[model samples]
Target: MAAPLAKEQILDTAEEVLRRFGLEKASVVDVARALGVSHGTLYRHFPSKSALREAVGERWLKRVSIPLAEIVKESGSSMEKLQKWFQTLIHTKRSKAIEDPELFSMYNALAEESVEGITAHINELIQQLTEIIEEGIRKNEFKRSDAGQVAAGIFYGTARFHHPALAKEWTSPNIDEEFRLVWNLLLSGLKF
Candidate 1:
């Protein structure tokens, strides 16, 4: 009987296979070879290459989400949290699961999967920001009427303006500068 593959072991093998061969060429067979496992054994755990790919992506997202949640929780201000959230998005935008924006989009299109956990994560931020905006409206810190839309607009709109592609290979120096610049442009009118 073959011993079960550990989750980390499986992911490591999958990552090596993907990185070496590219996502298109990397197959369950490749991962099995990398892990010294039989196809049947690997299939017992992952069913197919796509399933493994999704599992790997899910694990990676969980890794990033934990820290982003921490940053949002620890940030002192809603606006500060928003900036931190943008930083987190930019970082996530450059992960292995999304090596190329076009490739990632194609994967999304094929899988019909929505990165909605991310949208949910941003929703949490929006709720937090809504409260802040509400407080600001009362105290004249911000304008009122549609804090939720405004929050969504700031988030998605900024995300649209600074598409992950624009970040270019993750270390693009434009990320922070772009965030601050966009925030400044939006904040003036947004402020009370």
Candidate 2:
């Protein structure tokens, strides 16, 4: 007999179904059908279609956060870590958009409908930023300030480089230069 499907397997197939059919057309039935199972079985894993979409969004956002979180823990000057963190974030988002335009579009649509998951993802990213800022302050690399607030400022201030809404602009030749200018300005504010 085939092994019982796992939650990850369901999410994986759901993502494929989303990619194949796009967000508006994709449904729990589609995911189940793709997995060769009944919708009821998929429903056991995700109580509703909205819940499944949110879970998929959460999973995708986690992929983005995991690398940033590693940068936060690395043994380095916070300045280096901070720069690397944002660079990784921008690269990840841009590559995902470039590598799979359909999947990228689906994620943006899901993000719009999955506010709770998106908010949680944002909070997790902010918390990661907060840890890096706190370390910098502790090391005297950054001026004394509220780490959480500064982290939020950094995140929002650099939004154009990483935000999904601005994905199209990421392909512009000037995008890297623009990010460098913003990064330098934010760095100046953080340093003594």
Candidate 3:
């Protein structure tokens, strides 16, 4: 007999199901069947389909956030750190969009439906940026008086690169050059 599925195993299988069938068609039953169990078994791990989708979205964002968090912790001039952080976000988003457009589409849909998880993830990202900006301010490298506001502006200003709605634009031939221009402009504004 198949062993009872662990929650992490269920989430992993759910991700594959979502990837294979897409979020709209994937369901708790599908996940259970993939795991050789019943929908009731899956429910014990995720109370509802929405909860499962939220977990999937949370997992996707974690994959992106971990590296960014590491970059945030590295000791470097704020200018260097900020540049790398922005570039990392752009690169990560663009890579996901290009490498797995289908999965990216599923995530975009899930992000819309799983508001709470995505919202918290975004808030955490903004807070991370705020910390980096605060570091810069303390070092007298940036002129921003409000790190939170500055971080939000930075996130929004670079929305073209990271925003899922604008994913298609990341394929532009001059995207790198365009990002470089935007990065330079942002740095110029932030410099003391």
Candidate topping lDDT: 2
Q: Which regions of candidate 1 fall more than 4 Å away from where they truly are?
A: 1-3, 91-142, 145-147, 160-162, 165-179
Q: State the lDDT at 25 in candidate 1.
A: 75
Regions of candidate 2 where Cα sits further than 4 Å from its true position: none
Query: Model 3, 1-192: lDDT tens per residue?
Result: 767777788889999998888777888889889988889988888889989888878888888888889888999898888888888988888888999898888887877777777788789888889999999999999995899999999988988888889999999999889988998898888996
Model 1 per-residue lDDT tens digits across residues 36-130: 87878888887887678877665554654566666645635655665666667566656633466554543333233336544555566566656
Task: State how far residue 104 of model 2 sits from its true place (Å).
Answer: 0.4
List clash counts for every candidate, in order: 0, 0, 0
User: Model 2: per-residue lDDT, tens digit, 65-184?
Assistant: 999999999998999999999999999999999998878888877777878888988999999999999999999999999999999999999999999998999999999999999999
Q: What clash pairs does model 3 have?
A: none
Rank by lDDT, highest first: 2, 3, 1
Clashing pairs in 2: none
Runs in model 3 with CA error above 4 Å?
1-4
Question: TM-scores across all candidates?
Answer: 0.67, 0.96, 0.94
Give Cα distance to truth, residue 10, candidate 1, Å: 1.0
